[model samples]
Target: MIMQKGKVKIAAVGLGNRTCKYLRYVEEHGESAELVAVVDPDPSKADWAREAFSLSSEHCFRSFDELAASGLQLDACIIGTPDLYHHELAVAAMRSGWHVLLEKPMGQTEEQCRDIVEVSAETGRIVTVCYILRYHPYFMKLNELSSDPRMGKILSIKHIERVGKDRTAHTFVRGPWNMKEMNTTVFFTKCCHDVDFVLWLTGGQVESVKSEKGTRIFTSADAPAGAADRCVRCAVEQGCPYSAVDLYLRRKDWIKGFVAQPGESQEDMILRMLDESRYGRCVYCCPENDVIDRQSVVMEMADGVKAEVVMECVTDEKDRYTVIECENAVITGDESSIEVTYKDSSVPQEKYDFQWTRGMEFHAGADHQVVKEFIDSIASGELQTRTPSSEALASHLICFRAEK
Candidate 1:
């Protein structure tokens, strides 16, 4: 289905960090995708979109229902809402004749994920999950090399995600994702991409999953002696790495967007949030912090490929490391480069670099490429050929089974 020659009209549901990426993509590719409508419960988010895209008030909605009832025609919608709300919004958009670019995990439960797959098939809509890693050049190249005859059949694969300690504290400890039952597990929330990569690179279905997880460090027992519940009141806050002052106050640029509310200066906002919000709480003592700081999952694939994925929120640098052992070659890589060694001593080792930029366009530029692919697919009247929702569901199912 080739689309007619024109801009692919798009609406954004939930104006969060991921939505911001979609906004950036549409802005960058103005000729390919048009930002027509925006929805979020927060008016500030809606206003941000309206100002960014020059959208009229009528097109700025507070919820998906409002946008659907408005009767405005659109080619597709990007659902960047929270984990739990993905199914409802995505299904609604698909039923209304709009293609969907859904964020990963699909939903919190396996049932919700299957419903999305069903709805997508019923509606014949293109649902591309945000598996950005699949679009990264490094992984793309790795996939290419995996199929090379020289590599032979893959026997085993291991993937590791080292999420920086500060990030773990910021996002999983003091942030919205702190509670597993309320949000999702560490594997589903942070390492779903890894599970998907294992399946993709091995070309094998997951036969069984066994996992072990625990909050080894970020617990009340690990709190510093005499430390206050809030960093603002802690006597040792100046020296603590996860101090609210250091994390939020020192980083004014980072604080401005999310923390600094209307009429509040950066300093004032930081001080207030530290005194009143969970972001300023001691990481080890945060009552809401329940997710694991580290986890390991071992999986048996249908083709007899043994795979292991380790997720640790204790590193200084955040990146993915993967190693694949094939019959004739050993492949190893991080986010930027890959190294392949052939079994034959005469064959020299080959190294390839992806040259990915560090921040914003992280995941080795997959962040941008995924959006580009989504927009291109919609404009071309074709389904997303790669990293579709069905493929994402397979990964999500593995995470669910592993967590159980």
Candidate 2:
């Protein structure tokens, strides 16, 4: 995984919505990284990448095997495939002597995650799992404050991932990640970042976990009596908050490349997708959609720190609210701000605020920050893979245990 000519030549295995961030990074920061090739089974995605990166036809591969056989020089590979394919793709990339920037929930199962860790160690290839929150300014500040002596030793922590109802419908209800059987659990698919953040902030290994999960709203029995299977044909589509027509058509830019195809107008694509694709499926009536809409897990850490993680898909807003209690003070924050208050009467409560003035700034600008770090690490050979497979596995094991 050696850098050539001061730039890290990279290839993206999956060109989905998440991978767009990496592609954009390489596009903007040509001095640091170069996107040389892309691989996806979908020819439309290949075409999108080719135009996005100005890649040659020879550089567009339909599969990883094709890329490998092409003998293209790559310093690293970004694995943005679906959850289940992560283990195999990551292992193959590492074995091929390319460093890996894998998307989260390292693998579908604990054993698969362990296999990735073992392969990474065996190959001496850098494997950074995309736990983007670690790079976010707010969470980074929280980590720094936790280590301050004035904050005292941490006692317990509570983290809640509020997946807004609109997001739940767009993603978990009718999108690619609608079911546990086809993908993974809601915890792994959505809240693995939360789990990884808990591990990062606590700096302790989880000892045990107890969890309870269920779906309350998005089920067949909960569907309105007059509802149709697809929102485009439904009588209440106008008033429905989770209407596929409104989501895909009205909010075209929200998920641009994912729903809208190349050369197709937003209105036309929205109509076609709604009429033909699973994205148009009614939330409560989609039989194949079965992931839990809400869940909570209680975890005991090795250092006797108690932590509770709650994931709710029905919330009105999408934000991470975290409260960490220490021996002398309590710290609380969301994506944009943080506040700390001490028990001592003489001490005053302190607050820190952040400004999200640009695009993809919701996660405290971690979306691009993580990409910068990965590119810089590869270029300098410093390789600061903050969340390596072994580190990521701890959080994943907790998820696996809790699900049981």
Which regions of candidate 1 fall more than 4 Å away from where they truly are? Answer: 251-259, 360-362
**What does candidate 2's lDDT look like per residue over 53-130, in tens digits?**
789999999999999999998999999988878998999999889999999878888889999999988988889988
RMSD (CA, Å), candidate 1 to true, equals 1.9
Q: Give Cα distance to truth, residue 22, candidate 2, Å.
A: 1.0
Cα RMSD (angstroms) for every candidate in the order listed: 1.9, 2.0
Model 2 pairs whose backbones collide = none
lDDT of 1 by residue, 119-224 (tens): 8898999889988878867777888999898899999999999998778878888888888886789778899988898888887878889998865578888888
Q: Can you give the TM-score per candidate against the true fold?
A: 0.94, 0.95
Error of 1 at 247 (Å): 1.8
**lDDT of model number 2:** 0.84
lDDT of each model, Cα atoms only?
0.84, 0.84
